[model samples]
Target: MNRRHFLGSSGGLLAGLALPTLASAAVAAPSATGSAASSSAGGRGYRPVVTLGGRTLGFRLNNGVKEFHLIAEEVEQEVAPGMSARFWGYNGGSPGPTIEAVEGDTVRIFVSNRLPEHTTIHWHGLLLPNGMDGVGGLNQPQIKPGETFRYEFRLTKSGTFMYHPHADETLQMAQGMMGLFIVHPKNARERPVDRDYAFLLASYKIDPGTRRPDPSEMTDFNLWTFNSRTFPAIPPLLARTGERVRIRVGNLTMTNHPIHLHGHDFRVTGTDGGWIPAAAQWPEVTTDVAVGQMRVIEFIANAPGDWAFHCHKSHHTMGPMGHGVPNLVGVDQKAATAKLEKLFDGQHYMEMGSSGMAEMQDMAAMGSMMPLPTNTLPMMTGEGPFGPIEMGGMFTTLKVRDSLAPNDERDPGWYTHPQGSVANKVDPKRTDGLPR
Candidate 1:
């Protein structure tokens, strides 16, 4: 989004303009909260959180309270290069901007409803006055379209939380109305991390060649995402070697995700309730984040490489893989290809899935001949320097390198392995690194 979208000096904001330029590639989440590379930039004595594929929400001071404005509106959100969908979100993006504040700070939030119907923001897992809890009808009246509602509360705890609609939740949330709310401890004397990252896991079931997501589909969702984006589009999490890295993940989808990290063991240091005390934490390579819950994990980025970080559920790492496709594996389709060609009057037809779907990676190379539908991403991924990356959706890499500019969040591209370290051919015809 343009800086003008949220750079208001005063609490004043423009009328709710909810239709995001859905194909706009630049807006997602912030590279780092409070500016991680520039310590103490967004907060005092506290490291900023990095919302992958997102940016942090900026605020203004009003009297003694921190004031913010969130416009609930419709958006055209890009899931990847070839896919865009009609989504509803705060501001202009899905998994709306991260809100960073300190515990004990008084906050007054103005929510403008630009949505077609009534909406309310339920502060999931935060203890606050009943009226400020944002449960639509129970705690307060719904913010009807074109109306603005105010929520004032003092942060009583520090943790990773979320905010989404409490009214017409099934339709609203399924349309991608959500964002992360992060509160830091106020004391400021605690251990600070070198690189802190946060993101929300979301899923969509947009049919192939469609522009709007289906909110009614309960299961069999095909498009999984990190901050409403798929792999090759979602930027990698960058860090300096040996840095103490913190990653906060929240799940809004109905299913659970066993989030796994490659080349590092981390400890679960926080949850939806609050930060976990040191004595209670343990080391693990993967942690499960359940529906409507959050988990904070931390570890030393001692290893240097482009390490894989993603959900462990195999299907979650793929795109638009709708259920019930014909099981054509192990069936030789060369004869079928000839028949297809004959039926098409000599137009070449390529066989797919008989030898498994890996051939789809070369779909781009084949160009117009491939039968992929419009407005859908391929199940696999974009090309790495080596070849097709065998992943997508809810997946990204943590690029920990020995040399990176302080606070730099740009993708460093592919990792170059030392010559002898990469696997090589072992037959006699192979290069004679060792005596053949």
Candidate 2:
């Protein structure tokens, strides 16, 4: 299997999201430069969605209708550094390019199936004619291999929506065949935002040294991801301080994720149903996104700092690790280490988790830990300014800075604190009104 990594730039430009083999790769989304996704459409301003490690699907205006193309194909998705798996997705990437348009716009999506099996796309949460429902046999025909099909619908309302295969529903989606479909209101001013971002939540059970995701494993998913990529490998979302940032998250995995963000109290401004009324909106630091659901949260980026953003589930924030390992905490491994060292010529002797698993990460970081299998990532890894971040999986930072240029999606790096603002250690023996 070939190894791959996500595309990122050192400067302000954000790269497009698509594997090399995508059919519609020519028409890619705009590179992130720190600007709202707004454009002039029919004399009205339209804000385009920015997908994390993905592209916003572009369209062609033909006779007043926006036309888009989708190609269902195989993709080798890099879950994180040193880890990857074969997945099925649209336009050559799992959690395919985001489909965006405006309310009251007539959009025609041409889906071409290039996979070995037949597939059909179900436009989740869109009100349309029953024939356009795309439920394989229930309403429409399955798109056979090498065959193309079209789905046309009028956008009756604007909200957060999604699209996935309703054909094999099980094995297909389990292999990561999903994407977001966002419809901006006809009037961009209705729900204006400074920075709008989107991503899909997906989980896969891929064993170390393997190349394909185990679609059959439901309860034992070991890889949790945002936008088909993991922490350290996933890029941070950038924003200017005091900007109203909107993050739209869609869940396609079997499980739910309680996404939490540090430093801000946001409200669920929108759901799959529609935008929530202001009176009904409630402030929350974390929101639970269930399977086949979507949530949109918005907040003012008043705090200029790198805020931790991730799933609340502790296990969901870790990479590949043995779940059946024995509990060795507090065990006396001094004698065992000697015996094992002599048996293995003192080369393979090491105490694992004798005190805690955190030490294991330190050992690994120092290159003294046992070797991991090929294509495997450390369970807990990430270097921070102070020390190790001690996190993985669906983890990233919302970097809010006071000096980011408009649409400059470049990482602003670590936040520097002012004098007397950082926590300092106090002498334990003689401390006066200081932290002890």
Candidate 3:
């Protein structure tokens, strides 16, 4: 049988496979007189956590406990400019909201399941009791539809982590159910950072002329995303020059992502496992985040410019595309096009990819001539300063400026390059003795 047939037949078996048994334990007692808020008051100062264009998860204070609520439901989200998709997420956004807390503080997170199916939130890389691990039918009971479950745990460690459904793992995650969980160190002075940001890397396979993403896609994924958003829509990481910047990235996709930043060499400061010692850390321009893992990278924002930060995998930077298109790269279609144009009025066809594929951008800019299915994005998009960037998925910029307003999180627009800094064609008149 073919792969599709085998997958269809074994879907039920895969869903029924039992997860590893986890030891059940009683919930940890709340801290006596839980007033650790004063510890963060003047001692370490408030760490200004950034989430690019994303919002941080807010909490209510109840008897010295940081209480948060997350509701799992369906949401219609814009992946990029002019493109939107219906996704399953928490609190109405994919890659749900960023959850932030201070190390050593007690947090009470309440997850209400509004999805049609059961779900649970596994605090990825967090040190918590087995019963509160959020694995359905393994650690605790699944949060059924319309039911609420409470998970109380202490932030014993400080680092970047992730949260996603442990039940119906494949379909749920592919449908955009995930979030970033951050724990700041109590003593911010120990590892101080001027700007801290985090985002989750996810992928989806949305076939042409379709609105819903295919969750059963194992290898070929077309829509690569950052926090469930594509290029122009993915918010820029803004920072002031000379500031110490920390970017935490988590990968929930099936494939690994080798993220590369253009103008800086950064160090892998932390990982899902824990913090990497300063002595053992090495400088890298690109760091590979494996599946189900997270990596924290730090760098000094000394470069004052708009630099590209994106997945090194070239195809990951593209939007939804058909996989069965014919390869017209080196083909000479002039004669064929001439014959076809005679049959149609005012129709022009160009064979692309002969001299490097810049024409692909033009085609993308033209938009679809045929009507596409509802809620589907174009194969390529994203308007840039120069023109159509011809890029869509898994792409964003790190904009470092000399100065920015206090608490400014807005996109400062494109940068102004210094004189002679931009690339241009060499003058033919100046090439006196060059090879002709």
How many clashing pairs per prediction, in order?
12, 8, 0
Off by over 4 Å in 3: 1-44, 339-356, 363-374, 429-436
Candidate 1, 1-436: lDDT as tens digits: 2332233332233222222322131212346322454233223445567888778776655454666778899999788997888999988899888887878888777888998899999999889999998888899998998998889999999989999989999989999999999898876667578778889999988989897879898998999999999997888888888888889999999999999999999999999999899999989999999999999999999888889999999999998885898898999989988999999999988787887778777765556437679998888886777777779998898998888766777777788777797776677755568664
Assess every candidate by TM-score: 0.89, 0.91, 0.85
Tell how far residue 130 is off in model 3, in angstroms: 0.8
Alpha-carbon shift of residue 164 in model 3 (angstroms): 0.7
Please report how far candidate 1 places residue 338 from its true position, in Å.
Answer: 2.5
Clashing pairs in 2: 33-407, 33-408, 34-407, 34-408, 35-407, 37-47, 37-48, 242-301
> Which regions of candidate 2 fall more than 4 Å away from where they truly are?
1-28, 31-37, 41-43, 430-436
How does candidate 2 fare on TM-score?
A: 0.91
How accurate locally, in lDDT, is each candidate? Answer: 0.81, 0.82, 0.77
Best by lDDT: 2
Q: After superposition, how far is residue 404 of candidate 3 from its true place, in Å?
A: 2.3
Better of 1 and 2 by TM-score: 2
lDDT of 1 at 403: 88
